[model samples]
Target chain A: MTATARRVVVTGLGMTTPLGGDVRSSWEAALAGTSGAASITDSWIDEIELPITFAAQAAVKAVDVLTRQETKRLDPSAQFSVIAAREAWKDAGAPEVDKVRLGSVVGTGIGGIWTLLTAYDTLRQRGARRVLPLTVPMLMANSSTAAVSLEFGAGAGAHTPVSACASGAEAIAYGLEMIRSGRADIVIAGGTEAAIHPLPIASFAAMHAMSTRNEDPQRASRPFDTQRDGFVLGEGAGMLVLEAEEHARARGARIHAELLGAGLSADAHHIAAPEPAGLGVSRAIGDALRDADTTAADVVHLNAHATSTPVGDIAEDHGLRLALGDDLEHIAVSATKSMTGHLLGAAGAVESIFTILALRDRLAPPTINVDDIDPDISVDVVRKDPRPLPAEGQLVGLNNAFGFGGHNSSLVFRSV
Target chain B: MASEQEILSGLAEIVNEETGLPTDSVQADKSFTDDLDIDSLSMMTIVVNAEEKFSVRIPDEDVKNLRTVGDAVAYISQAQG
Candidate 1:
C-alpha cells in the first residue's frame, strides 16, 4: 500500500523549561497559569551591561543533573538538548535501531552565542594561550544535534534548521520529512536555546520589544492583555522522538500522539516584526492543515505565538481569521508564552508540548494575567480558570511560532 | 610537571576532545584525514583550537602531514627541540 505513506508518530517526549524540567510539570504549570519569567542571575549577567533584565530560565539547570564532563564540554544550549533528549530516549525505552536508520534534527536560533562571548572574554583577560580548546564545538548551532546523535549512535543523518523562533517547529517538520522520505525509521528532534544573555536582551529592549515590568517578573509577559507591554526572554529546550507509525507499533511503544503535519514559510517582509496582516502565518496554518489532510474544523485548540507583544497578537488573529475562517470563533487559543516568556528559538518545541497535552487531556490551559483582552484580537482566547473541553471523539491541535527573521511555522498533531 | 609521555597523552586527548570519540576508536599512527570519522572542516577547527591551546605555532605544511596524535606529538617535540 505504498508503505502507507510512512506515517509519523511521536513515541517519546522530554523538556527542560522555566516552569519545570519535565513535560508533566511544565504542563501542570501551564494549566495553573504560572509564570516562569524572572530577573537575570547567572554569573555572566554582569558582563553584558544590558537594559532588558528579566528572562524565563530553565526551572532546573542542566548542570544540576548532568555529568560534570558533559557540562564542561557542551554549551548551555547543547546541554539542555542532550538532557532533554536523554530523558526522551529513556522514556522511549531506549529502543534498538540500526545506527544507520536512526537520525536527529535539532535547531537553535543562535548557536553558541554564550560560548563565543565567554571565550572572547577569556581571550581578552587571559590571552590566547589559555583559551579553552572546546570553545568552537560548544558554540556551533548544530552542536546539540551532534551531541545527541553521538549519544544514540544515530548515523542516518543529523540536521539543524536555523529558522529563529520558528526553528523548533521547523526541526519537527524536518523530522517528519525524514520519515516520509524513508531516510530514517526514527528521529530525535527538537530545538534548544540559551540566549538569555544581556547583549541580546538589551538589543531586543532597544527595539522596545521587552517588558519593563521588573517588579513582577511572573506577571511581566501578559500576552493579548490590554496592559501587555512586551515579552520576557527565556531559555531551555524541548525534544521528541518521532518514528514511523508502523515501526513504533511493531515495537509496542506508547504513542503520545500522531505527527499529523508540519508547514514552513517565510514572511520575506521584516527582519523582526511579523507582517502587519500575518500573510505568512495564514499560509503556514493553511499549509499544515492541507498537509495533514485535515481542516480547521478538526482543530479544537491552538498554541499561539503570542509573546505578549501588542501588535503581534493582533496580526496572529488576522491570520487565524484568514486561515480558519468561521472556525476561529470555536477554536481556543492558548497564549502559553504569556507565562513561560518567549523561549525564542525554543518557543515552538516548548509550547508544542503544551499543545499535545491539551489534546491528550481534553483541556486547554488558560492565558493568565490577561486582565483585559485585546480588542484587536477577535477569536476566543481561553482565560482565567483552566478550560475543559467536552469529551470528543478525536482531538486535533495546532501550534504556531513565528521568529524574528520572518520565519513562520505551524505543526498539527492529533490523537492516534 | 608535563613529561614527554604525559605530553603525548595530552596530545592524544586533543583529538578525542574535539571529536567526542574515544582515542582507541582511532589509531595513533594513522592519518586523521584517512583514518578518523572527522570531516575536513572539523580537522581545520581541531588544528586551530589545538594550536592555540598548546601555545605553539604549527606551520601549514607541518599541519598537512601531521594527521594523527603521534604525528602531532613528534612535530611538537621537534619544534621544541
Candidate 2:
C-alpha cells in the first residue's frame, strides 16, 4: 500500500433493477428469493421470431420515474443512470462539494441501441428530414456519464469504461482511483443498460448465450443448477456515492461500506467466452484481496458472476476455488442473478450493492431455483433461504463481475 | 388545405405528449420555450411529429421562426398548401 493512498468509502447506493425499483425494495425482493424474469410482450417479440422470448425487465419503468421531457431528450440507458444517480445523490444527504472536485463515471455495455435503431427506422419510413437533431448525442456510449455530469455539475471528469459486462465495476474502480489520486473528492459511479430490444435479444440468442426456456421464464435463470441453460438478459442501472473517508466523515454521511479496492484482469482468450482455466478470474480475485490489504481468511461472502450459463458458472467456481483455496468452503456464496437476471453492464454495480447490503445487514440473500446443485460447484451455495453472516466479526465480502470480452473485475468491501 | 384549427390541435397534442404539458395549457399565442419549458431538442421533436402528421416538410431554417404555438400551426398549415 502506498503511504499517500487515501481511503475510499461508500456513502450511499441507488439501483433500479429487475428485482425492484430502488435499493431497499430490490434488496428485500432478493432476500425473499424472487425471480424477475417474464415473457416478452412487446409487438416486436412476434415480429422478429426471437428464440428467447423472456427477459428480466426493470420492475419500474423509466418513464414512470423520469419526466416526459427528460425521457425524450435522453436514451433509456441515460434515463436509468439519471434516475439512479438522483437517488444516490439525495441519499448522500446531497454533499456540498465543489463542482470542480465532483465527478461521474457511469458505464454501459451497449449504449443507446434503442435510440439508434429507432432513428434509423424513422429516417427510412419518413425521410432524412424526420431524424431528430439529438440522435447522435442520445446514441453515444458516453451519454450516461455526460448526463450524470450535467445533472451534478461535475467538472473534474466524466468517464465511461466500456468493458462489456464488467463496465459497471470498472467504473467504480475508476472512481476509487479518482479519489485516491486526489483527482476528485466525490464521484458518482455505476452503470446502466437498456438493451432489451429485439436486435440485442436476437443477437444473443443467435450466439447461443441466452436461455431458451420460454415456457418457464421464472425458473429459467437457475445459476449453478444442473438444469441451468443460459442467462436471461436484463436492464437497469445502479449508482454509488463514493467519497474519500475523511470527506464523508466530515460531512457526517452514513457510510454503508468501505470501498476497499478493486482488481482487474483480462483473459485475452476469447472475445465472448471465458478462459476455460479461470486464470484471469483467479488473478483478479487474488489482486483484489491484496489491494484491500486483506487475505482470503477475512472474506466471508461472495457475490459470484454466475450468469446462469453452463460454462460461465463452472469457470467462476474454479476461479473461486483457486483464489480462496480452503476458505472457499466457509464463504456464503450467493448467485443473486438467479433472481435479478444478468444485467449485463449494470450487473457489477447492482451486485456490488447487494454485497454491501449483505455485510451491512449481516444476511446473505438466497440464490433461488437450484432444484439440483451442480456436482462441480463445491462451494456452499446459499439456496432457497437467506443465510446469516458470522455473528461477531467485521465482515468482508467480494463481488466478482466478468464480461463477454474476458474482462474480469473483483471488488472487496468491508463492513463499516 | 389543412384548416387552422386542425393544425393547432394536432400540434398541441404533439407538444403536450412530448413535454407532458396539459393540452388546455398549450395556447396558440404562448411561446413554446417560455410556457411549456420545451428545449431545443424537444422543439425538434415537435417539428418532426408535426411534419409527419401534416405531410409537410418544415425546413431547418424555418424552425427558428417557430417560437410560439401559433407560429408552428400557421407554418404547417401554409406548408400543406
| C-alpha local distance difference test of each model | 0.85, 0.93
Model 1 CA deviation exceeding 4 Å by range:
A1-4, A46-48, B1-81
Highest lDDT scorer? 2
Instruction: State residue A130's C-alpha deviation in candidate 2, in Å.
Output: 1.8
Lowest lDDT block of 10, candidate 1 chain A: A44-53
Cand. 1 TM to true fold: 0.85
Query: What's the residue-level lDDT of A264 in candidate 2?
Result: 99
Clashing pairs in model 1?
none
iRMSD for every model:
5.0, 1.9
lDDT of 1 by residue, A80-129 (tens): 99988988888888998898999999989997888999899888997875
Worst 10 residues of 2 chain A by lDDT: A1-10
What tens-digit string does per-residue lDDT give for candidate 2 at A1-416? 47679999999899999988999999999999999999988788888887888999999999999887789889999999998999899999999999999999998999999999999998899778888878999999999999999999999999999999999999999999999999999999999999999999889999989899999999999999999999999999999999999999998999999989899999999999999878999999999999999999999999999999999999999988899999987899999999999998899999999999999999999999999999999888999999999988789999999998899999999997
Model 2 agreement with the true structure over B2-69: per-residue lDDT tens digits: 79988888887898878778888888989988877888888988888888899988888999998899
DockQ of each: 0.10, 0.59
Best by DockQ: 2
